[model samples]
Target: MSEDKSNRVVSGRVVSNAMDRTISVLVERRVKHPLYGKFLRRSMKLHAHDADNACNPGDWVRVEQCRPLSKTKCWRLVEIVEKAR
Candidate 1:
């Protein structure tokens, strides 16, 4: 099947990779506060499908939105941007 190029993509660090073929990614973004107009850091944890279980904790990776692979997983591993240092 052809992959969707318009799918959302995010870069983050892999926080957990204990699951069989899944990894938890922590995506952080800075947003300005509505009232104060001060930029603040915010983060979210996303479950991404790792078909080969190639990701490990601390790895920087890119994930792309995809069809749901499980109850909480709708993202797929795209590439490892940087390895754990």
Candidate 2:
């Protein structure tokens, strides 16, 4: 990988790519309920930099942490894991 290995990496689905060189990703994680011993789903929207604008809505992608490129963008697209069908 060209990027630093220490950076955090996560996978998510592209939610939007309307902005130039940027894509919004929807990341979902399962969290265990502290009291009930049940699993709950939580999700967040992340703004990831996609230099090629190659990601489309519903595409699965991997993003890694990097120096903040903007006020809310600190993650960058690493690769497209799956394309929308």
Best by lDDT: 1
Query: For residue 83, what is the lDDT in candidate 1?
Result: 93
| Tens digits of per-residue lDDT for model 2, 1-72 | 597469889999999999999999999999999999999999999999999989999999999989999999
How high is each candidate's TM-score?
A: 0.91, 0.92
lDDT of each: 0.96, 0.95
lDDT of 1 by residue, 13-65 (tens): 99999999999999999999999999999999999999999988999999999
Write down the RMSD of all candidates, one decimal each: 2.8, 3.3
Model 1 weakest 10-residue run by lDDT: 2-11
Error of 1 at 3 (Å): 13
Residue-level error in angstroms, candidate 1, position 11: 0.5
**Superposed model 2: Cα runs more than 4 Å off:** 1-5
Among all candidates shown, the one with the greatest TM-score: 2
